[model samples]
Target: MSDKYAVPNKLPAKQVNVMTHRKRRLREEESHHRVKRLNRSFKLRSKKRDYKKPEFFITQYLKAERDSKRMRRVIMKNNFLKGVDDEEPKLLVVMHHRAHRVASKECTLIMNSMGLNRLHNTVLLKNTTESLALLKMIEPYVVYGYPTIQTVRDLIFKHGFLRIKGKRTAINSNKLIEEHLGEHGCICIEDIVHDLFTVSDNFKNVRSLLLPFSLKAPRDGWSKKIGVSYSRGGEYGNRKHEINALIERCL
Candidate 1:
């Protein structure tokens, strides 16, 4: 009875080998699953790192390139169109208002409606009959003129911005212009220049879509007397083509 219970405690060698093999297989399976989990976690971490990469420098470089090309095209176009329309009288007008001095309520209302609520704030508009009437109504508080092609080009290229969702967004890329004004055939800055310069049918849309330009007081400074007309050497009223010189100095 004792032998039956205790003498057979050691198993056969074949049985022992089979048990050892089964334990090794279980350990190998656990190691394989752990390796797979570690690889998946590493891949997820790499994706997050890729998403964090900064694009600021690339954007700035692209902007610089676009500006350079646009400037060259503007220069060529201006050269070709020069002298041909010197006397044709451009309808593209530049306007700025003197807000320091008191103005009549009627004049103030007109100026504000035209978005000339601040001093040295500039706006470009097509010289239509209605616009002419508005200008005359607030003539005493504003200075206006027929800007040259160069003036218009410089203003839009250097200081131009788009009115996007009621915000003043700078014209950094043609992509941005296309995104907003594509339907009007204004997919790039060049299209804007053409529309504004030619006073095309889409001029109203293009002009209205622009943010009002805020310019520095001309480097030459303004006259102390804001009440007099520009022709008489004061700051207010129209200067006609002479406005180009004033804007250039400010630029």
Candidate 2:
């Protein structure tokens, strides 16, 4: 048994680089084992410390505290910087169709690239020149506009999710947010909300981390069909702030 467990003799040191590669592989194997041990210890300690509580309670508490601090900061900032630094505009684009006769394949590809592949799929976009150009290309198949703070919050709380390891996971606890986005200064749900509502510098990263919101069809359905301008009482094009009313019904 002892002989079976012994480390194998090193290969004949042919090519100094091969020896270096072998050493690197061994180091990686050791590090992997170390990490496994640490995780095991952590789980054991957790079980010993609080058998009754769920494993994620600490993550939830930390997340709640972080969110509270962020909210307080927002309140204080709003009070002091009411008009000093107005937030940049953001666009809430909703897809009502996949392909349209008026839309080219390139336009549909742009929409799909933006994660709006299904009917009633919604995404928040920064109002930059590039985004505006893309929206122009797909304007005939979607509705978009400036969303109010309440609308942003409601959407996150009700339909918001984080994409982790390419899986759509619910925002049920702060631990999830921290695990996925803590490095980006978003440790809680409120951090993402603030970043999006204010269109902060981290908005792009936060938006990409979030899964597209799958909204229900607008409560009475579209009054006007797609492939026309919203000004003409059509469903496509900008609804401005009026988009809020449409999103509310879907919510």
Candidate 3:
């Protein structure tokens, strides 16, 4: 017989057999395919992903949050502030951004000296329909933040977004608001500040101030008489300690 087609002549003497060898080879190949299919299924169920996030937007948000916390720390000093607790601010110095922090600090200082801290009034006004509800709830002083370029934009956006349709709440207007104060009563702003802060030399006779440190100039018509102006925040930069002196003079 030809060698290619010939059966093994020595098979009878062999320890290993062709049938056993063929079965082992088929088992290995079947196991390999089974393992491959299992791997494919596992990959399909895996939670790992190659997705990435938008870098710039995330960085901007993080930066803004960090800045906000830092500003809050300076504005809401533990020695003076206790957060917006069960009580609201009495002299609500409304502000929008970085200047917001300075205005808040000034007002806080003003309120502390004027003794309005005892009255448990005042709070920052947010532009929201819920803000109106909260206003009714808190009866805040509506001190305006300076309508600076950005603040003006923010105001327009906020007002457009949060304004209510019904009659907007009117700020307080009357003689009760205009108290006699400041250097023999010659300066009207001091008395108003005092009323807003609720301070007295006698340590008594006072109520909460409404939005006293606000960016708003003095109330309408009386602003010129009182010499009120929109104070640039820059004026307070190095002379911050002088704010205490200015407030004291008013007191």
What is candidate 1's lDDT per residue for 46-131, written digit by digit as tens?
77453433585566566546545644554565433323234545564555655553335555566677777777778877665566
Pairs in clash, predicted candidate 1: none
Local accuracy of candidate 2 as per-residue lDDT tens digits, 101-148: 322445547778888777778888877666665665566667888899
Distance from true location, Cα of 160 in model 1, Å: 1.1
Of the candidates shown, which would achieve the greatest TM-score relative to the real structure?
2
Q: Could you tell me the C-alpha RMSD of candidate 1 in Å?
A: 20.6
Worst 10 residues of 1 by lDDT: 77-86
Q: Judging by TM-score, tell me the better candidate of 1 and 2.
A: 2
All candidates: TM-score? 0.60, 0.61, 0.22
Residue 220, candidate 1: C-alpha displacement in angstroms = 2.0
Off by over 4 Å in 1: 1-90, 101-103, 223-225
Candidate 3, superposed: residue stretches over 4 Å from native: 1-56, 64-190, 195-198, 201-209, 212-238, 241-251
RMSD in Å for all candidates: 20.6, 23.6, 21.8
Give the Cα error of residue 183 in candidate 2, in Å.
Answer: 1.8
